[model samples]
Target: MAKTTKTGRPISLDSVKANQVIELLKSGHYMQTALEVAGMPRSTVYAWMNGTRAQNSRKIQDFVDTIKKANAEAEQALVQVVRTAALGYTVERVKQKFVNQQNEQGEWVPVMVEQEIIRETKRDWQAAMTILERRWPDRWGRRPPTINHEENEVTSEDLPEDFL
Candidate 1:
């Protein structure tokens, strides 16, 4: 399998369409001719021919389940190779580029990392809320203030960024 530049994700090209191209190649068609016949992109066809495109976990799991269920040893072995390649992503070289500066009290704080994560989570939550609101406007829309509402009870602005 081929590897991606980021995360070194395994790339798989064992789709039904690729199989058809492979069949054409095995039947004496030139690889280039086969790929052209398949109408697939050059990069995609090259990846398929080289067996390098199966980097997705869901696809790996599907392959494993399929071969195991069918009890096909050869196919199972191929699936195992795909699974192994897909799982071969290395994080060892992922150096911690972040260096936390010490405060006056000499305590190193992860302020930036924490803030970025919080911001990203908040953005994701807001996007989810927007989707939910679009899906069910009446259910999520603002309601009229009740006469018996508690004075101490917080309104929407009191909620956290992500929660709101």
Candidate 2:
């Protein structure tokens, strides 16, 4: 296919497919996959969204909305994962399998074996904090302390007297 020219919009792009891409994006799919569904390249999408093409292009708002929606959904999911893990989770499972047993006839026979497994999970505090910082910056972010210097400009005379 020919590259998108002055408009920076792929010739293959269509509203139905573009909406599908947005849905996929909102579902937390990668950009490459979303672009594929949209039948466009990343460059073309960005150009259309960021106004490299027409400022008032209908695609711009739709693209922006798609990105924002996707980001919000992803962030929400991340926050939920972290929160759920922090709250602590437990899993209990039962597994059944067949094991080979030596029969009285000196032939192997299948025997059913049962096993129970229990697991407990917790979120990584540091990693969860990182996600929280990214998702809810104002609430969970830890900002580096700012150091304010008293001196605005230092002249030669402001240097230590001992140096002179």
Best by TM-score: 2
Off by over 4 Å in 1: 1-14, 48-54, 57-164
- Candidate 1 global lDDT: 0.54
Colliding residue pairs in candidate 2: none
Using all chains and alpha carbons, the TM-scores for the candidates as numbered come to 0.24, 0.47
| True-structure Cα RMSD, model 2 | 10.8
What is the Å distance of residue 122 in model 2 from its true position?
A: 5.5
Q: What stretches of model 2 exceed 4 Å from their correct place?
A: 1-13, 90-164
The sequence of per-residue lDDT tens digits that candidate 1 reaches over residues 1-164 is: 99757655355545775556556654556556766887756775455335586535566455435433433444445545554444443322222335588888999975444322111111234445554566588998656876755767778999999995
| Per-residue lDDT of candidate 2, residues 133-164 (tens digit) | 87799988888876656756667888998887
lDDT of each: 0.54, 0.72
Clashing pairs in 1: 1-52, 2-52, 10-55, 11-52, 11-53, 11-54, 12-53, 12-54
Candidate 1 backbone overlaps, count: 8
